[model samples]
Each structure stands twice: as structure tokens, then as C-alpha cells.
Target chain A: MATILVHVMPKPEILDPQGKAVGAALPRLGFDGISQVRQGKRFELTVDGEVTDEVLANVRKAAETLLSNPVIEDVVQVKVVREGGCGCGGHGHGAGKAEKDLLA
Target chain B: MATILVHVMPKPEILDPQGKAVGAALPRLGFDGISQVRQGKRFELTVDGEVTDEVLANVRKAAETLLSNPVIEDVVQVKVVREGGCGCGGHGHGAGKAEKDLLA
Candidate 1:
């Protein structure tokens, strides 16, 4: 099983109150070096088996139609975080590689 | 500048209404292979400049205290998404290697 991380963030032109709330609170907490903070939603899709192109397309469609408002936000990234288990000795699948391959 | 991705998710024992809603909707949209869908919070902390241990500590603290309720949710993962520009070549600093260093 592999988990796909669909990261949806507010579009640049739109105002993000939630993100701004965090950014506003940062300096008050005596934190430095943090210029801005953007809050977003992450959807974890755990595949029952291997991930395929069709599955990816459906997931993308879900993200676009249900998970987020396309006009107000965008799918910033989509990556496979875990593939079955940790690839201890090349036995586990390459989750990162899978995402790169999908992108390419 | 470096951006830290703080991912917080509900503990296994707790009920995730938001996640359940999505999980239930997947099949309705013809999305197969998605056994479960868990929704979580992703905070992008964009540092003003370089990331330091002090900055990491502060960010972690913020995540623990304000971003999530430690009792019901946990900080599952924290990683550096980007550090400066994409490391296309040797001249560009590594964004991923830095995450490994931090983990180690």
C-alpha cells in the first residue's frame, strides 16, 4: 500500500485568514526567521494495493472537485509519502521515485 | 529561505469526521484503490532566511502548542520542503539532504 499526499493551498491572489492568523501570532511568541505561514489541507489517500495511473487521475479529480475549491486554491503538490514499508534494503518500493516518475 | 512542512494528524484512537467524510465520498466518485482518506493540517513555515536549530525549535514549539492539540493530534512528520532555489546543480544548495541531516 502507498499513501498519496495531496497538498492543497490557497491561491496566491486570494486572502488567507487562517494563514495570516498564524503569521500574526508568530512574532508575538518570540519566534524569529519566519517570514510567513500558509495553512493548507493535506489529504492522505491509502491505496489498498499498488497505485496506478487511473488511480492517480481519480485522486486528482477528487482533490479538484471535493477536497478543495479550485477557484480559491490549488493543488500545490502530490507525492507518495509511504510505499508499503520503509525500504530498509531496497526491498521496499521507492515512494519518492514513484512521484517523480508520475510527474515526468 | 527554507520552508518547513509541519504535518499534524489525528491520533489513531480518535475519530476523524472530516477524514471519514472524504473516505465515504471516494467510491461515489469512482475513485478506486483508496481504502481510506485521512485529512490533516499542513503548515508551511517560510523562514526569513536560513534555518537554524533555534528556528526549528521555535517552529516545533509553535506546532505543538498552537497549531495542533497535542492530546488528540500528533505531529507525524516535519520536513524541509524547499531551501533557497531548486538544487539543479552543485551550485544550488540541497533541499532534501538538509532534511536528512535534520533527521539524523
Candidate 2:
């Protein structure tokens, strides 16, 4: 199976209050290096087979119609990720302690 | 000066209802390839300087304390993406139309 990652983030023109809250809270917690924060939604999709163009296209349609608010947000990216469990291209999953691979 | 992407996903044992909903809905919308869906949080942080270890460490602390439920969820991955506006190793941003970079 193929794992697809869909990242839906707010449009630049929209104000992200949750992100602002995180930014404000971080400084208070001593995470000083961050200048800004923007919050978003990530959907990890486990598909039935190889990640083909038609599969990606349908996922894109899902992103536009159901995943995000088209008026205020947009799908920033759609990625074909290596499945979970095996380190195909691990990304940073191998580096993290509690990482879970949905593909597994 | 740097853009760090922190992705927090539920631990494998944790139940992800939203992801299940998305997975269930997609097939109805004709996206038949998706077998399952896992929902998570994506935080785009614009930091003040280069993405050094010190910066990442503090962000890790933030992820542990403020961002996720340590008991149920985990930080699956963290990455430094090319800044918002520029195309340096653009990942998939260049391919999508509504993609927005917080660094810009």
C-alpha cells in the first residue's frame, strides 16, 4: 500500500488564532527562537496500492472539497510517503521515539 | 531565518476518529484507493535564526509540553523546510496552486 500525506493549512490572508496562541504560549514557556507559528491539519492516508497520478488527483479533490475550508484555507501539500514500520525513506520517523507508521 | 515543521500524530494505540471519518467519506466521494486515514497536527514555526540544535531542542520541549498529549500521542517527525517564498528544494509546494509559505 501507499501512504499519502495531505497537509491543509490556512490561507495567508486568513488569521490563525490557534497559531497565535501557540506562538504566544511558547515564549512564556521559554521557546524563544520561534518568530511565528501557523497551525494546520495533516491527514495520513493509507491507500490500497501504489501512489499513481489518478490516486493523487482524487486525494487532491478530497483536500479541496472535504479536508479544508476552501474560502479560508488550502492544501499546502500532498506527499507520497514511505510506508510506516519499514524505513523506506524514513523521513524523520526513525529519529522520533514515538513515531507510528499508519502503513503498518 | 528558519522554517521548522513539527508534526504531532497519535500514537498507534490511540484512536483517531477523525481520520477514520475521512477514510470513510473518501470512498463515498470516489476516492476508492484510500484504505484508512490518520489525523494529526502540523505546526509551521518561523524562527528567528538558523535552525540550530539549540532551537530544535527547545522546539522539542515545546512539542512535548504544549503541543501534544505525551501519554496518547507522540511527535512522529520534525523537519526544516525551505523557507516559505523561495523554491530551494521546494518539496511539493511548487506543484500545488494554493500552497502558502508562512516564511514569506
Q: For candidate 1 chain B, which ten residues in a row score worst on lDDT?
A: B85-94
- What is the C-alpha lDDT profile of model 1 across A30-70, one tens digit per residue? 77677888888877777777677887887778878888898
Candidate 2 wrong stretches, greater than 4 Å? A82-104, B82-104
Q: What TM-score between 0 and 1 does chain B of candidate 2 receive?
A: 0.75
Model 2 CAPRI quality: acceptable
Question: Taking the candidates in order, what DockQ does each have?
Answer: 0.44, 0.46
Q: In DockQ terms, which candidate is top?
A: 2
Give the DockQ of candidate 2: 0.46
Query: The CA-based lDDT of model 2 is what?
Result: 0.69
Which 10 successive residues of model 2 chain A have the least lDDT summed? Answer: A95-104
True contacts kept of 1: 0.67
